[model samples]
Target: MGRRPVHVVGRVIVGLLALALTGCAAPAAPADSALSLGSTAAAAPVALTASATAAARTAKIYSIRTTDATKGVITVIGTLSPAPKTGTRIPLHQWIPSARRWQEVAHGYSSGTSVTIKTVQPGSVRTYRIAVGPQAPYAAAISPMISFKHYVWRGIFKKGLLATGGNATPQFNIVPPKEGPRRAEADLLADKGGYVWGEVNSTGCSFVRNWLGNLTDGTVRTSLHNGRRR
Candidate 1:
């Protein structure tokens, strides 16, 4: 074969150099690209505008009044304007008496114009609050405390009375004293005191009464097995 032409080597070198130059140049970016490093082209920080914060603070207030002793439910109504910005989410929290702090219950995007929370029973009294910004800025009204009480009445025959038709009688009672055994020492004690008593035909009888008390100071006391004559 004829001597390899010197121009062939030169052409190869030129092509390689062209390719290297093309690779060194920055790649083309989309028109909406956010990868710019210059300060002028940098992404603007998302801020919670005063108006948005105010709207969040103005969330409508609804009360949940429950006479039920077991559980309580509350419904909250509110509206959002201009939708929440990215990286921002709505938060739901309930007041915790034991912890003496607010705890997060649920979180969701602010996509919808309105937000509603249903059946929030994490605490005896739950308060709902929202965060419009990265940090919490608005708090909903403190929901009425849902009083919970277990009204349970139990009766057990006195160990000895169960076997024999003893004088002992089974009795049921209520709190805040009411009618029932009057003269009987057991009845008298339970009446004058905080409990109510029922008749006892069997060896032993017992009862329990329950009710909701104010939040300021609440207490529940159980009675002793034997009645105190005093």
Candidate 2:
């Protein structure tokens, strides 16, 4: 081969130096505990930071989450530590400002460590609580009231978050359920497990069927109505 020119050699050296510099300056990838040598994950249970004050409550209620799946239909869930015994009858209560008492709105049974309660919550924001029965060996307990506000979608700056088929609807409502002095002092949210219970007051829950959109196109809408407490 012919002898390389001095400029060509200089260019090659510069390129090599640039490559080395880039290698040194590149950011390290985040540690993948599954593949990293020194990365480790917690092997023990984590402590919860709930702030519930009740003698009957041996644990804390981390937080409450609400989801609006269909219009006027809402699913309420809560997490708590020291799960309740299965088959325990609990009464879900709603605050009655007029009567100055917590009225039973719905009822649910404990299956696991958490409670899943469904309600048609479309009216003005209302507060809810779960009352655990203290029958026999169990002491009567009440979960911190979680006041859920009705879900409303804001189109401002939120129009571009969804694709044509992508639903930009609310994934979950970011509000607590408790209200007033009996409410949880701090918002202790649990990503996994914490302390929570749920109940319902028979004849206290309500729902309404509503029809919304109708067009030649395949699109549909709903003008659903929520529950009413008497």
Candidate 3:
């Protein structure tokens, strides 16, 4: 009977040891499962990053200059962000008051990130801008408007003048004094404050008196009339 009790104790100890091993092994299952899940999550991020859409490009005109006043030549310089492809077409636009719309005046090709466009426009004051059309993966963009003023030179003198649609009876003889050849030229210019001024110059004979009329919206044309001589 004592041997039977000892055998029963031995079986009980073996059962406890097995239970302890099962408990220890149970904890290891969670640790190994957690490690495997973390590795799977790390690779899942690669699939999440597949083929993202590209960002749109930006365009702007940084400078506009009247490079040649005499020729009325202007240059429009600008840049495109994330630089566009080589030879991309960039167009220059001019605001037409008569049509009340924008007109394409000139165009240039892109070189690196920069583009330079030049056009000759004279005899008017207006607004200008540059634009680029959407060329795949890039959005269409336009630059801010820039104001440009160009003047035309006019001459008035013994190149005798007559009033349009007016009676000619009051005409005074404007013979340049026989002393020398006389000539006069004038142009309408604007100040930085947007004030318009008429400038006149004469060679040989001098203009003794002058007058300038108020600028009105109807003043689409600038005219210089010479009166009296010294």
List model 2 lDDT by residue over 1-230, tens digit each.
Answer: 35568778999999999999888765554454435544333422221212122334442234544465333455555543456778666566778888988877666566766666666554457787776665433466677767766653221112221211113332222223233221112221223222222121223223322222233234333222222346
Alpha-carbon lDDT of model 2: 0.47
lDDT computed for candidate 1: 0.42
Per-residue lDDT of model 3, residues 10-85, tens digit only: 9999999999999899867877777868878677767655433344677787787778654568888988876778
Over 4 Å off, model 1: 1-69, 85-89, 97-100, 107-111, 120-123, 133-230
The TM-score measured for candidate 1 stands at 0.29
Candidate 2 Cα misplacement greater than 4 A, ranges: 1-56, 59-66, 152-230
Backbone clash pairs for candidate 1 read: 169-200, 170-200, 170-205, 171-205, 173-196
Worst 10 residues of 3 by lDDT: 163-172
Per-candidate local distance difference test: 0.42, 0.47, 0.66
Quote the positional error of residue 20 for candidate 3 in Å. 33
Report lDDT (Cα) of residue 18, candidate 1: 94
The ten-residue window of minimal lDDT in model 2 covers 157-166
lDDT of 1 at 148: 36
